[model samples]
Target: MYKSLILLLLNTIFINVLWSNDYILNINDDMTAIKVTICSKRPLQLTSSLDNATHYLSKTSSHVEILNGHQLRLTKPDSCHWLIIPTNTESTAMTGQLLKVPTGLLLWRNEQIENDVINVQSPKAANAKLVNHSLPLPKINHDQYKWPKEPSFMSLFAYFGDFSQKTLRISEQSGSNLSLQINWLSKTLDSQYDSLISWINQVARSFVATSVLSGEQTVQLNLFASHSSESVPFAMVYRGEGTSIDAQINPQASLSQLKTDWTLYHEFAHLALPFIDRNDAWLSEGLASYLQYPLMQKASVLDEREAIEELWHGIRRGQTNYQELSKPNLTLAQLSSNMMEFRSFKQVYWRGAIFWFQVDLKLRANGDSLVRLLNRFNRCCRDLNSIWQGESLSAVLDQQIDYPFIQQLVTQYNNSTQFPQTDRLFNSIGISIANDNQIKVLDRPKLNRFFANFKAH
Candidate 1:
């Protein structure tokens, strides 16, 4: 009798331990179970069968669990997804009670399941608006930020702000769009924000889809003084306040005067390109840089001389070695990896734009222009997914102009060793290359001859 009681007690303890080791993610659905193991090591590996299921892994910060046998059961509450398994875990300690807290990646699959419902707005019943405004303002003596009465397609949200003292409020309205309220503590600051909104909305009119014009789609542009990440986490950032059109008083150099100059034109230009996936990232980024100067000139926002100078600037600062650039293009993976290697190569931004500029110049010489090329891209290809890395673009050009010459131009641009001598090209454009490496337009040739009418502005 005594022996029997001890055995029963041990069994009860084992059940309790098993239940205690589980981490409940409260998932609602299940899918094909891909075997995954977690470990406290450098690399995690999953079995070959789970290769197709690796994309759904997400890491959570709520709690840590170190299982005994160094392993624990991972389950999905629902049944339509596949899970990815991590490879670095030790199989021996696969199941048990934890000894210490360790960071482990959570692996799972994408399956359709009902999400737990919760009320997001109910907590703040008294205040209808969600507002945060602890951002520091520029010392410039001006109230610059205020939204216009005219309707706009853009909306904005800011986080990590103190609402009571500072001044901005963003909240969803009953309609599809959101309400943006910017209260500059200083009136001058309000004016700055107002000017910013005016510029943004003016450019945004072309960006809104025609079908969505009446339908509600929220687009917000959040501007803040600084982010913990230093640079803007997103492409558009609130760097600083400008006291004058030319003087960008960015003390932190949040947005350098030079970058701001480019950013204003480039960010606005993105509306013209297809924004579906990474496939078109090359075209999108390249086009943004390519169009920025031309568009600015068209609007009479900058001088044609200045725009050409900027293009030349890109070429000067751009990469010269074609082999190093081509090495990354051998495979998609290498190309992606090279993007992260900022120290080694010039980004697609500079190099790609310069290449397009050369292509444009070459095309014009052959009686074809970028305008024709753009119309072709817009009509023939839907977006990047439809356009693969092949001879399709080249083939399209052949129909319009001299295909052989265009190909030779592209080859020259792609080859780092082949570059037009700066001194020669600059002089041809009526710009003199200075000994100190500054662009001096000897005569500042007529804008009509070089760029569109807007460039002469």
Candidate 2:
């Protein structure tokens, strides 16, 4: 029932980057089976699927098959040939086999492909050709990368990396444009991914390209069909880390069919925060959820009134869910024992987002805004290599704001399952909801600069 509510939750499940493996990908005419030729380095003990790739492998033991539930262990031959089938299973915890880019387009992680060369062979294409890619060989920093204990055949697993530039779909621009990373994964110009590419570039350039948030960062997207219509379409970002993020959306679905929420913006929001443990997931997902509204408006992806109204609506959703399902007399602390074992996006995302917004609304009342506070954090720690936890982020925010706002909000509210009430805050901002699922923004003096953060454009 809550499957749809958890779409954004899966977006940031980025893991360790796959190091190195050369690949020759051949797609069949029916789109059902794929033949992947992996030329890996030296002795190999394990080739794991970060998502669910091994599930589709023919498990005859005669061929590559699922191992240890999630990993794919080769049967023989240090270098191997594996066939992949298209399947319909979806889950963040267990999905890494299939490369789900746009229809007729495939997205492979940089790690799965070989370091030096990769070849693409699709029945629908002109011919099998080497894909000229942009990822420089990762420096050989460690010597421990040897064939693990087992059938010793290889020396080293080249750090080819997952989510690589080799998959960009642009067919032309042979000269200078090959170096430019801002493009799509499809080779055809008429592809819907091409149009989506333009829209995404517009959003990044206008909203995040220059913001203190995203500076000189490159994003490689691995697309997939949305797990469900209710799931939020989200992108897992890997600006500096490997095992980069994976996002889900209906490959053939038109932009109009996208959820009313700005899915891209929401996923992009994760880039604003450092990764946190799943236990404190609210921190990362909350920042993504909260910022999506303002940034979506900044990019003109959403109207100002629409952004605020959707936020207010989300607040109600969180509050109602908590009221109905939460334990009695719970404290809103970071480690609230009442927290659900499986975790609900309603609490972790919606309520967590409201927690921060509530903190911001109050700070704004005193001539300060969360925008200024976060910008302060970005100034010193925006480097992609550094990961910041939610607890530490609150500490850093407190330092920037010169007040204990985030600290207090997180400590006070995060300890309990109780949601921070937003009725007063919503009313103060002047949003009115009429009967037939409609919303109107009222002209309130306090509402004047409430959206100043969105004016960055």
Candidate 3:
């Protein structure tokens, strides 16, 4: 009896001593009962809860209790979490780490817990944005773990807002090297989503030949209105033919059901852009815009005449807005230097697309075609590690298409002080730019550009 009592007393003392250490460890799964001893270096009001428990805030209390089996349990203590995640938790659900506070939270997990902080971006304390890191609270932890480094705004959107999107099985495709899945949560005319998916998959098949990525890789598609520090996360808000903003889709778009097709096609093309030096924003964006018309034609979404007509209108509209487009006088160089500017960057889509349209005309005159040129460009872009730029692209185009025409077009666009006369340019090909108040087929010499191209091919 004396020996048993002595042993029990030793165990009790060990537990108390362990609890007094600087950190408390937790590794809980779907069936776990996690316990955390909350501490705050600064006076803090902690607001937190488990999956099924009611949220509780402790402005005066010293501790909070959380039951297990919850989805996400966060402790926004006055300061960042300072506790060390014990070594045992490394192979459990808690291995993947996320500090549930602002980016300024300079804390780490495990042995890295001593003042070694991964870089992060913090929003104003007034506004609580989604934390940029992936909430890697996976139930099954692995042996080899790669903690996420600091995320860009684009990546932050991918990590946080994805949880909020409702599931819509947009489309899926697999290639030997890569796989892609597309889905949009909106419930309205899902047909637009379907069309976008079809167009993207066609581009992927033609460019990446990814029809075999059954299980190795997967990509998810989502959309949102106000994403945190993200670019291209917002859908096109079309307001008539000349206006669109990434921040808000024009409430007035769908002026006619027919116009929605090109808008969708334009956004979907962004998905296929190659991993190039972002400095080549003009090229990738311009190429994508230029390619959209042809891809739509190939997919039967647009005919030859419709494609050229669209380009003419885009150019005219951008030209009229020329004063505004150049107001900032930010060159493609400044725009590509950072993504923040890329979000607000103006007219690359419009001006660059027109440049390509002119090049297409010139190439056809020289017995070459846009379709063949794009096939070559796509091949160069497909190499994952290769970086592409205007110089490299010009070299490739020189071999397959009209290089002088491309050069002149690029120069005119890069240096243009005003928007081109889009309607007058279209007049050269026999088409008219439509007004926002009216849609009509012009009865001029627009010997259907589409039909001529199909015939020539």
Candidate 4:
């Protein structure tokens, strides 16, 4: 009994120490500059995504030296180092000024800060907004707040400004409920607030239900309303510190139009997997493309036939892109690695969808499924901040099953210069292309059953 009690005491002490805040941020009243204080004496290096980050650093600091246009090096280690970063106020939106969490931008002895807490001291007029894996920050005092968990390297992106905020609590049947915090960065979105929130709630619930992810989760969605007439002009998901999405929406667009928009579904589907490296973007983009249609169908935004048609349309676009951009010697992996340089998005995305589609068919043949595998992955291995290489992700998934199918497919497709052959695969599932270039969904039992099972799931 004594030994157990001693062990428990030690564990409690360790937990507290591990979660202790290591950095303090003091922001000025105007939100134009931030002063950062590192709690540790360790030598620190700073890197920024900004091209002229050094120009923004306070010139009075002799200890800090410019390493490059994007990086800074501290000359000597001290008990505490004060770094000040100034913001370009004129260039940013009126809703918020982004003050990046510098603790997240640092390298301690040239390594990532894996276990540090960042505490913020800001003026009451300015609110610090950051998405992190930990529970919402609790205020120490009226002006002081600390992040409760170890900061994910990716979670360091933060913004400070006066903004409209709304929280939606979604109840889950199993595990913990999901807390979605929506930050409206623009006043223009106010008109569609009710409809927009409703659409987000529906899709978020649909995602959780379809993926079977029951963990208590928090998602921070920053909605930036644009004046453009387009609906949901663009959106991107960020992971590591926490799951957050930045979506540019048009306030003028109807809720029905928002529900049917493929961009939102695609971005939400990304939550199913860990952050994959950009070199293997084909895998990540492919998974999102493949799942988006089904997700829309499941959410009732698209019917069975409509979903299948959309899928076919995307696949055909991929095929057409590959034919036009085909390089005689370049493999899919090579093209995927330099995808941006080659503008091979359609080919990479669609080919990736094809890869997953084929894998799903194979899995279904054995009474297993991509959905089941993804559910299992979510339950066991899905870490929002964890970065995975393509083959490494495949290897991990392959370990979950009896046969090594995922890795085999990845290897074969990565090496082949040709686009994945899907004629036989589609025919086997009762989809065919007519000579008139239209896709026909055949009335075979296999195809009907596939659609039925898809909707039922």
lDDT of each candidate versus the true structure? 0.37, 0.49, 0.39, 0.69
- Model 4 residue 186 CA deviation (Å) reads 2.1
Candidate ranking (lDDT, best to worst): 4, 2, 3, 1
The alpha-carbon RMSD values of the candidates against the true structure, listed in the order shown, are: 16.2, 14.4, 14.1, 6.9
- For model 3, residues 1-457, the per-residue Cα lDDT tens digits are 9999999999788655443322222322321222333333332232212222222211212233233322222244333332222223222222122222111111222322322222222332443332232222111121111222222111111122112222222223322233332323322324345444444455444323312122222233333223323322245421111111232222223323333345444544443433335665655566567666655665555666666566555555555454554555655445444436445333655666666666766676676655545545444443322345666665555655534556545555655544444454455555554567232456433445533452211
Tens-place lDDT per residue, model 4, 185-240, is: 67678787899988898787767666445465666688888777789889998765
- Give per-residue lDDT, candidate 4, residue 56: 52
lDDT string for model 1 (141-174, tens) is 1221221112211112211112222222222122
TM-score list, all predictions: 0.44, 0.58, 0.46, 0.77
> Considering every candidate listed, which one attains the maximal lDDT?
4
Clashes of each: 47, 41, 11, 2
RMSD value for candidate 3 = 14.1
State which candidate, 2 or 3, has the greater lDDT. 2
- Report lDDT (Cα) of residue 388, candidate 1: 33
> Which window of 10 residues has the lowest lDDT sum in candidate 2?
152-161
